[model samples]
Target: MSEPVIWREPVVEEWIDYNGHLSEPYYVLVFGHATDAVMDAVGLGPAYRSEHDASLYTVEAHVRYLDEVSLGVDLEVRSSVIGVTGKLLWIWHEMYADGRLRATEEVLGVHVTGGSSSPLPDEVAAAARALLVEAPEEASGQIALRR
Candidate 1:
C-alpha cells in the first residue's frame, strides 16, 4: 500500500453518540467518502457517470477500529489496491489522525453496468487497472470486521 490520502473534512454533526468520540456509523461514512475519492482518482467520476452509465457497488466491507477518534480530530484515510480479478476489486484503507492510525477497513467492490452486477466495460476496467497499487503478500484477514 501507499501513503494515506487525506480527505475533505469531518463535519461536527458526524460526531454522534459521543461518549466523547465519533460514533461507529460515522467511521463508515468517512471511509465511504474516501472511496468516492478513490473512484474519482481511478477515472470513475461525474464524467464517467454521465457518459458510460456505469458505476461500482460495494459487495462487502470489513473494518477494524484500532483506537478512538474523538470529536474535532483531523483524520485522513489512505487506500491501496489489494487485488483485482475479473469484475472484482479488493481495496484496503486506513484512517489516521495527526499521523496516528485509528482504524482500518478492507473492501470488495464489483464494477457494474448501471445497477446490475454485469461485468464492467473493458475501458472501465482498463482505467481502474491503471490506478491499482500493488499490495503486500500475506495481507490475509477477515474481509469485514467491526471494532
Candidate 2:
C-alpha cells in the first residue's frame, strides 16, 4: 500500500476546549480542511466549481475520536482514498497529535451540479485513484464513531 496523504496543521489557541485539549468538533473541522485539500488536488476545488458549476458534497461521515489533543499541538492527518464509484468517493483520514493517533474520519461524498447528482470529473477520478491505498491497521476499527 502507498503512504496516506499527510495533512498537517498546528492547533491554535482557539481550538482548545474547556478541558485544555482540542475540542471534539475541531477534529472534524480539521479533517474537513484536509478533505478540501484532497478535493483541490483532484481538480474539484473552487476553480473547478466556478468553471463547471459543480462541486463535491459530503454525503456521509463516520468520525471516530480515539484520544485527546492539547492546545498548541501539531496535528498531521494521513488520508487515503478508500474507493470511488461513478459519482461517489470514499475516503479515510487518520489524525495524529503529538505523534499519537487521536482520531479517524471516514467519509462518502458525491459530485453534484445544478442541484442534482453528477458524474465525477475525469481529473478528479484519476487523482483519487492515484491516491488510493490499502486500509491501514487502524482503519479496521469501527466504521463509525461519535465525535
Candidate 3:
C-alpha cells in the first residue's frame, strides 16, 4: 500500500470566475497536478515517459463541488488510488481549503502509448500495482455527497 499524496496549489487570477471563486477548468488543473504527483510516486514520470513511451490519459472524470474556493487561498489536494484493473485505474481526489472539504473528483484513466491511445504493456501494469494504494473502506473526516 502507498500513502496519500498531498499537493498544494495557490489559487491564481486566471482560475477565478465571475462568482469570484476558482473556475471549473482550474479545478481540473489542480486534479491534473495531483495525478502527476501520484504518477511520479508510482515510478512513472518523465523518465518512464521517455523509456517506455507510455503514459496515462484521463478517459472519464466526475467532480462534485461541495464548497467554493476564492483567489489567494492556498488549497491542498489529496489523492489516492481507489482501484485498478487491466490498464485502467480509478483515482479519487479531494480538495481542501482551511481544512474544509471543498470539492471531490473521481477520475478513470487508462495507461496508453505516449502518442496514441493503446493498451498499456504488462510491465506498466505491474509497476502500477507495486504503487497501488487500497482505498479505505470509507473515507473519514470528510463529507462525501456524491459517491
Candidate 4:
C-alpha cells in the first residue's frame, strides 16, 4: 500500500502568526487533525466513541517543519501506517503545499477505555493493518521531486 491523503485544508488567516508563516501550534493542529482522520477511517470515530466508550490517545509525537507554508494555500496531509501493536498504533504524516514537501509528523497512540489502556477494537485494528506500508528497501525518508 501507499501513503494516502488522509486530510486537507487551506492555510487560513487565523493559522498565520505575526511572522506571516503558519504558527508553531497550528502545525501540530493540522497534523493532529489528520491523525483523527486516520482513526475515523478505521471505524474509530464519533460513532465508535458513542458505541464503545473508547478512543485513542496520542502517546508520543514528533513534528519536523521543513519549509514555510504560505497562507491561503491548501495543505495536504499524506499519511500511512508505520506499524501496529496489540494496543497501539504508529502513524506518519507528510504535509505538502503546491506540491512542495513542507512537514512530517509521526505519532504513537494507544487505545483507551474507562481511563485505562485497552485492546484496540477489532474493526479499527483490521482497518489500520490493511494500510500498513513498509519503507522501501532503498528509500530516502524525503521523496523530493527535482526540476
Candidate 5:
C-alpha cells in the first residue's frame, strides 16, 4: 500500500490575527483542505460528486490547538483514516510546523447523496479501509479543565 497523503499549506498574511499569530479559523480551514485531499485520494472528489451527486459531509470535528503558529511558515498536515464504515468515515490530521506538532483535528464525515446518508461506493469504501490505522489516543476526547 502507498503512504497516506500529506497536505501542505503556506501561512499567508491574511491568515494572521491581530495577536500576530495564525488565526483560529485558518487552522480549521487547513484541516478542511486536508479532508478534501483524503476524499480525492479515495475517489470521492469533485468528479465523483459531480457524477453521482454524492459527497462526504463533515458532521462533527474536534480540534486541539497545542501551539501557536506564526505567519510565513509552511504548515504540513498528515492525514489518516482511522475508521471507516459503509456510510461514515473517521479521519485524523496532525498539523506540523518546523518539525513540531502544532495542532490536530479529528473529523467524522458521512457519505451523503440527495441530502441523505448513503453507502459509499465499493471501490471507494475499500480504498478508504485500506488507509485505516489505529486511532490516536487523543482522538474523540473532550477538552478537560486542567486543575
Candidate 6:
C-alpha cells in the first residue's frame, strides 16, 4: 500500500494572535489547504474543477484545538479520507508540530456541479475510494464543557 499523503506549511508571523500563538483562523486555513491537497490527490483539484465545472463544497466541519502552535513552526497535517459515497465525502485532519498533535478537524463535503450536489465522476470516485481509511477514534465528537 502507498503511504498516506501529508501536507505541510510553516506558520507565519501574520498568523500569530495576541496570545502569541497561531491564530484560530490560521488553523482553519491550514486545514482548508489540507483539504485542497486531498482534492488534488483524488483528481478533484483545480484543473478538474475548471474543466468539469464541479467541485467539493464543505457542508459541515468540527475542529479541536489541543495545543499552542508557535510562529515559524513547520506544521504537518496528516489527512485521511474516512468515507465517501456517490455525492458525499468525509475527511479528517490531524495537525502536528514538534511531533505532537496540536489540532484536528473533521469535515463533510458534497460534490457539486452547477451549484447543485452531484455524484463524483467515475474516475474521481474510484480514486477517492482507493484512498479510503478507517475513521480515527477521535474523529467525531461534541466538545464537553468542564464543570
| lDDT scores of the candidates, listed in order | 0.75, 0.86, 0.80, 0.85, 0.94, 0.92
Better of 3 and 5 by lDDT: 5
lDDT for position 62 in model 1? 81
Poorest stretch of ten by lDDT in candidate 2: 135-144
lDDT string for model 2 (1-147, tens) is 756777899999998888998888899999999898788877888988899889889998888888989877899998888888899988899899888899999888999998899999787898888988766565546645779
The lowest-lDDT stretch of 10 consecutive residues in candidate 6 is 1-10
* 1-147: candidate 3 lDDT, tens digit per residue: 666788998998988999999999899899899888877866668998888888888998887788999989998998888877877877788899989999888788888875776765666566566666766544333445985
* Residue 119 of model 6, lDDT score: 94
Q: Which ranges of candidate 2 are over 4 A from the true structure?
A: 136-147
Q: Model 1: what TM-score?
A: 0.82
Could you tell me how far off, in angstroms, the CA of residue 73 lies in candidate 4 after the best superposition?
0.7
Where is model 3 poorest over a 10-residue stretch in terms of lDDT? Answer: 135-144
Query: How close is every model to the real structure, measured as TM-score?
Result: 0.82, 0.89, 0.81, 0.89, 0.96, 0.95
Candidate 5: residue 84 lDDT (0-100):
94
Model 2 TM-score, 2 decimals: 0.89
lDDT of 5 by residue, 1-147 (tens): 346679998999999999999999999999999999999999999999999988999999999999999999999999999999989999999999999999999999999998899998999999999898889799989878999
lDDT by residue for model 1 (109-136), tens: 8987777776656665675566677764
Candidate 1 overall lDDT versus native = 0.75
What is the per-residue lDDT of model 4 for residues 80-142, given as tens digits with 9 covering 90 to 100?
888788899888888999999898888889999978999997878898898888843322345
Tell how far residue 109 is off in model 6, in angstroms. 0.8
Residue-level error in angstroms, candidate 1, position 46: 2.1
lDDT of 6 by residue, 1-147 (tens): 334569999999999999999999999999999999999999999999999899999999999999999998999999989998999889989999999999999999999998999999889888988888888898779889989
Cα-based RMSD of candidate 3: 4.4
Instruction: Give lDDT: candidate 3, residue 112.
Output: 81
